[model samples]
Target: MDHKALSAHQAMLGTEVSRRRLLQLAALSVAGTALTGAPAHAAPPADKHTYRLTVLGTTDTHGNVFNWDYFKDAEYTDSANNDIGLAKISTLVAAMREERGAENCLLLDAGDTIQGTPLSYYYAKIDPITGGHVHPMAAAMNAIGYDAAAMGNHEFNYGLDVLDTFDRQLNFPLLCANAVDWHTDEPVYQPYSLHTVNPEGGRKITVGVLGLVTPGVAIWDKAVVDGKVRFPGIVEQAKVFVPQMRAAGADIVIVSCHSGPNTSSSYGDALPYPENASTLLAEEVPGIDAILVGHAHLEIPQRFVTNKQTGKQVLLSEPLRWGMRLTVMDLDLVKVRGRWQVAAMGAHLLNANTVPEDPAIAAILTGDHATVRRYVNSVIGTSAAAMSAATARYEDTAAMDFVNHVQSAEVARALAGTPEAALPILSISAPFNKDATVPAGAVTVRDVAGMYIFDNTLLGIVLTGEQVRAYLEFSARYFKQVTGAGPFAPADVTNAVTDTAPNGTPDYNYDTMAGYTERLTYDIDIAHPVGARIKNLRYGDDLIDPAQRFVIAINNYRQSGGGNFPGVTTAPVVYNAQREIRQLIIDWVSEQGQIDPSSFSTTDWKLTANDVPVVIQA
Candidate 1:
């Protein structure tokens, strides 16, 4: 390979030269005699020593095998009409392999493979792969022929036993460089994988793929992984392993990072390291040619960041979550001094909606899919009145209250006859899915499950009245400040994009509080600054006492510091039995045989602008 050509290419890209400017420069260099009437030299022929290697990546598949939604009992459809599932992605992978030559292509995933849909939940909680049942994700990925995958934070949701079972069923390795044994300080999973691609007539290319997951897992899944495994910083691990991969004769290095490119952590300072550190990893480390980013659930077709130490640009891409998109990275490698060196690289995303589901993948998981479908569709109870969470983020709704009612009741029952039993009990509920609804009559397990999408467990934490107010203020940051109460659309006021939430606060982060034996009420004064948003916070009929202690029914995710909410992580845990909150809701409905919203529903909270109730139009 010519060093001059590589240098010029990098310089052009560094200067942000446009395609037209590049074409003009090429014409001027190639047609030397056009202006001077001198003898013209022809352009050099294509390099035979150059090879194109295509790597396909997917992240946050989240147990989706088919394009069907078990909760809705129909095909999944979002506002964007984007198709999902590994079956759809399988077709795209097949075409790429065929087009690029199967020997020249590699497939990878950035994790969050299990525990999203009812399909994954059924397998993890009901049949359980630990009991010798094959994980649908493992079966589908094995059929599609994956080279490797990273371990996502959610992979630890079901504990190490389940993760190990899924890992054993995979045809490829599950890599995570930062997840190390607590006592041994040694990597628990494979750090990196090496693949040798032989170009038809050129030198074989040794592609080294390293996987790293967010250290936030240490805090998010502390209950399941504490003392057993610990997650170090992503960049910290990459710096140690990239050198080893180079020493092992790797010509090109690629990272499948389960962290996002953004340098932010939702868990605050709980951990010393940043949760999403892909950008930091590329900038601080050398020898990394590209990275497949994940966990942010955002689509980034292509992004290039310059390495501070090497001054070489590193390519990064993150396909949207749930197999909605697939990232394709193409690397142009040239044989330099008898070794293949990466000369150029770029990536783009392919929408799963562009292709149909691969029959082979669908056929492979049909039985598992059917079983989950039946499980979710089973009738659990009946709802006298229909309830929807469409306005839960901006206003109080019965749908969300139902979640709090069941959670608080369970926590209260557990704390019965205990020292804290006399304390006022409150429960926090977040609008997980805006589309979740409990239709009038015939409430199935799916209806209840759809409301609480996460597999979070129930937990009871003690928080002071002052801390509770602070928590509500932090959650109020989800709304944008406004003056007039003149009918505003929900989208116009909610999910305020700010420094913390560059893409806007997700629905799961905005929580509303509900009382168990008393009425806990507050007003989110969106007309004021964030810290002063929670006004008129009260317990029962009087203003809340600053020093008053209360037991709050919370989820394991929040109590574990998943959302960086104030005071929860340090709060005293009163109860934690590792009980799934979703199942509790199911059981609550089954035991009662009816969901009467009037029994638990109350207009306890509302959004207000300058003490004037805000009217949010749907």
Candidate 2:
């Protein structure tokens, strides 16, 4: 789910159903077929016939094999002081399996196995797994014994060839039921995986795991997935597969979905399905005992929803992203006649901070980690003055201007001889990282990579001045309405929580525009409502004309509808070379050999409230 669209979905369950009430229904959900041939009023089963199964799950582990921050060149830390990495999770999994008995335990990951850290990026682009080099994520997961994983949207970032190579290297199956071939509508990867667990002195239990990914992938990765694959809604595909799993003799069915439990989408009405639909999947589809939710990056210990048709409760759990936590689900089964039926289910999260990194996982990934570290630390160029994005979200800073500069330069160079080159060029950028900085003396690959964290590619879209104003108005929703401006902290004015963003809008959703060869200026007036926030919109010295035409250098995520920004998705694409934006910035600096802020930095925008400049306290 996009950070800006994490709002609670009220329409799916109607006004009468409270989210708390729905989550309280987490007890037991047995398949009606599993209790066949048993009397309706039969006596309770004896203790001897009961069996227990434990499932350990993780999600959105975005390529952190160790608890290190490649950008900072140190151990990763946050305000919460949580530890991250698969190494720490591996220790927790080992301890759980040992205590619960290895045979009764299964380990699974919900998705996003690759593509966040420098290590994952190195394998995907620099060293490339397609060249016979094993992906470090695959090697680490295999060593830690992951039974299966679903496909995350980021898995398609480097294209299908790299994704397929990583899949082949993994010892376990990479499953995604909804991701189907565009031509044949057949599954592009395994739909589900069946595991037969044999308990001590008990009948064998068949566990069926169905995997589904967010349909927003169609919009987010349109460049790579356009004619190759299509994604159906989570509930749409679950309704079809749950019955098949039951008919195939699965005593228990679990869904590992790379979708959130919320029922909202960032892409507005562009797609027919909601981007986050795990809760809907449970309520609409029957026979699912539990679900492992992903993609929202939320820490949901446990949530329960009642199936509308069966009146059975389905348990759902999601560990926070980046290996910060683990979800443990325990299911108890009681035998009726000679078959096992789900008696009860429970789930909770375990903090990875409490455990130490497993030495074995470190041993397997140390070489790869070291190589990435060296590559990121190598000096690229020198900066004449330090530039920081610490205040970029609330104020215009040179760090973000540097990003816009590189992007606009690349897009302009690509359109040099084309007919579109005659038009004015503008660029859009977001404050992806508040801590990103470039030192005054020297800049390394890590410094540049930190400024532009996402692996988004670049594209040029033509937009009229009216559409550009609409786009800025949409981005202005990131701020709360302030009547009179006094000195306020940065957080006091930004990341407004509204009906659309229950958790508050993230910094990445707030974009600022810069001109390539001309000056584009505007003021975001917080005294006015959202749609009317952009004030004093001007291009150079004249007011922007509504019918004026210009080309904007934008990232693929935005052009493909990532933030649901206005007009960009349907805008005419004049240039798309599939070039990664971060790499472009790095190459720009390397080629220039120096970063001088005076050449590119300009303050073209500011915040105001009723004609008074909004003052932000340090």
**Candidate 1 clashes between residue pairs 3 or more apart in a chain or in different chains:** none
Mind giving the per-residue lDDT tens digits that candidate 2 earns over 1-618? Answer: 021121121012222433233222211111111222233213323455887777889999998889999999999899987889998777777666655666888888899888898999999999998998888888778777788888888898899999999899888889999999999988899998988888767778899899999999999899999999999888999888889988998889989999988877777778999888999999999999999999999988778799999998898989889998888787778778987777777777777776667777776677888899999999999999999999999899999899999999999999999999999999999999999999998999999999999999999999999999999999999998888886888888999975556677788889999998998999999989989999899999999999999999999999999878989988999999999999999999999999999999999999999978999997
Candidate 1 positional error at 172, Å: 0.2
Q: Residue 348 lDDT in model 2?
A: 71
Cα TM-score per model:
0.92, 0.92
lDDT of 1 by residue, 225-290 (tens): 999999989999999999999999899999999998888888778889998899999999999999
Q: By TM-score, how accurate is candidate 2?
A: 0.92
Model 1 lDDT, residue 590, Cα: 96
lDDT of 2 at 415: 96
Clashes of each: 0, 0
Number of clashes in model 2? 0
Off by over 4 Å in 2: 1-48
